[model samples]
Target: MLPRVVRFDLLFVRTDYSDDDAWRDALAAATAVHPSNDFERCGAALQPVESPELSGLTSAQLVGLPRADYLAELAVADAQTMRDQTVLFVDLNELNKQVGRTFRAIPSQVEPIVANFSIANMDFHEFADNADPDGVFRGFTR
Candidate 1:
């Protein structure tokens, strides 16, 4: 039997753009060609990661977890290592804004990395069935 995987949308971006229409457009355009799933089926109800603080991680160690490409690679690798089917739903809108000018350039930088990984492509709804709807693996520092 396939492993019972947990899933949750990782809003790489903050909540500032949740109400921004232009941001949504850009996000849709970028995600459209992404080798993932149909963004249209991705629902808005998928719980947002509320805090920018990475869970399950201590602040001191987070600074050293990895940087840029390395950090992204770690996340993907960790997900794959799980014994269950796990999906990390990443939201690029807030992510783009966080890096300011670099935001728009992000999809290009991270997409290739994510594509090469064995991550699964799923919508918010599908992910919920796998992961805790209210509990995103925020990585604790402890």
Candidate 2:
């Protein structure tokens, strides 16, 4: 499920298959890789962008803070989207690609919803936990 949820965050292949069978076949090929004999069937939920659950908080706090806490914070207007304005980037597809594996796109994975890039939230504290103390931008944790 995480793979399906994170795949878009990981790659931009093509999720717009007009055919369901085509989509499944493509999904299989996309996930097949070194150490991975095949793709596993699993269930995942799609939270609508406008849905009550995903409506409020900025993109940042959604991950930096816990779901309940952030949801509560989001209930109030003018709330901080995150603990801070810190910015960071994590390449979600690196692990697979390192082994010469490719990533997949999620067009039909969900409706084509556009996120507000104008908003973002972050907690440097959360990011620091797994950050490379050596102060390099190369990569982290392989």
Which regions in candidate 2 have their CA more than 4 angstroms from the true location? 1-14, 34-142
Estimate the TM-score for candidate 1.
Answer: 0.26
lDDT scores for all predictions? 0.28, 0.25
- Tens-digit lDDT track of model 1 for 16-85: 3223454344344323443434222222211122233443432233334333332221222111212221
Tell me the tens digit of each residue's lDDT in model 2 across 1-142.
1112232222212213234454444334323331312323232222212223433444233334333211211111111112211122222222223212111122221111112110223322223344455322221225
Candidate of highest lDDT? 1
**TM-scores for every predicted model:** 0.26, 0.19
Worst 10 residues of 2 by lDDT: 72-81
For model 1, the local distance difference test gives: 0.28
Model 1, residue 61: distance off in Å is 13
In TM-score terms, which candidate is top? 1
With candidate 1 superimposed using the best TM-score fit, by how many Å does residue 14's alpha carbon deviate from the native?
A: 2.9
